[model samples]
Target: MFIEYIAQAPKEHQKYLKKMYQLLKEELPEATEKFSYGMPTFYWKKNVVHFADNTKHLGFYPTPTVITAFKENLTKYKFSKGAVQFPYSEPFDETLIREMVRFRKTELEELQ
Candidate 1:
C-alpha cells in the first residue's frame, strides 16, 4: 500500500517519500507498515510515525507528545499538535528525524 501510495504521488515528490520510507524502515526495523488517516504509518507497539506528500511540503506525524518533546528543535519548521510540515524546498534533517523516531520507540518500550 505504501509503494502504491508513493507511485501515485507527484513525480517530484517521489524521491522525498522514498527517502522518508527508507529512513523510517531503517529506524524501525521491527515496525509494521499500514495506511492510517490516508498516510503511510509505522507501528511498533503502536503507531510510532506517519508521513505523506502534500502540495508544498511533506507532512510528518510523530504524535503530539513527540512533537512537544522536540518542540525547541522544531522551531524552524511548521508544526501543529501532532504533525510537522517539512517544506519541499528544504533538505530534511535526517539526524533530528532519527532522534525523534528513536525517542518514540523508547517511549513505547518504557510503556510495556
Candidate 2:
C-alpha cells in the first residue's frame, strides 16, 4: 500500500515521495505502515509520521509538536502547525528529516 501510494502520486512528484519514504523508513524501521488520513502513515505506539505527494511539493506530517520543536531548523522550508511542504524542485534535507523522525520516535518512547 505504501508503494501504491507513491506510485499513484503525480509522475513528477513520485521520486521525491519515494525519497521521503526511504528516509522515514530508515529512521523508523519498527513503525508499521498504513494509510491514514489518505496518506502513507508510519505508526509505532501511535502515529509517527505521514507523507503525501502534492502537485508542487511533498507534504510531511510529523505532528505539531515535532514541527514546533524543529521550527528553527525548518525556517528554510514551508511549514505549518503539523505539516511541512518540501518543494519538488529542491533536494530534501535528509539529515533534518532523519533527525525529525528520530525525535518523533523518542517522543513516542517517552510516552511509554
* Candidate that scores best on TM-score: 1
Using all chains and alpha carbons, the TM-scores for the candidates as numbered come to 0.97, 0.96
- Name the top lDDT candidate: 1
* Each model's lDDT: 0.94, 0.91
Worst 10 residues of 2 by lDDT: 1-10
Q: Give the Cα RMSD of candidate 2.
A: 0.8
Collision count for each candidate, in order: 0, 0
Q: Compose the digit string of candidate 1's lDDT tens values, residues 12-78.
A: 8889899999999999999999988888999998999999999999999999999999999999999
lDDT of 1: 0.94
| Model 2 alpha-carbon drift over 4 Å, by segment | none
Q: What RMSD, rounded to one decimal, does every model reach?
A: 0.7, 0.8
| lDDT by residue for model 2 (1-112), tens | 7888878778888889888888888888898999899889999999999998888888999999999999999999999999999999999899999999889999999997
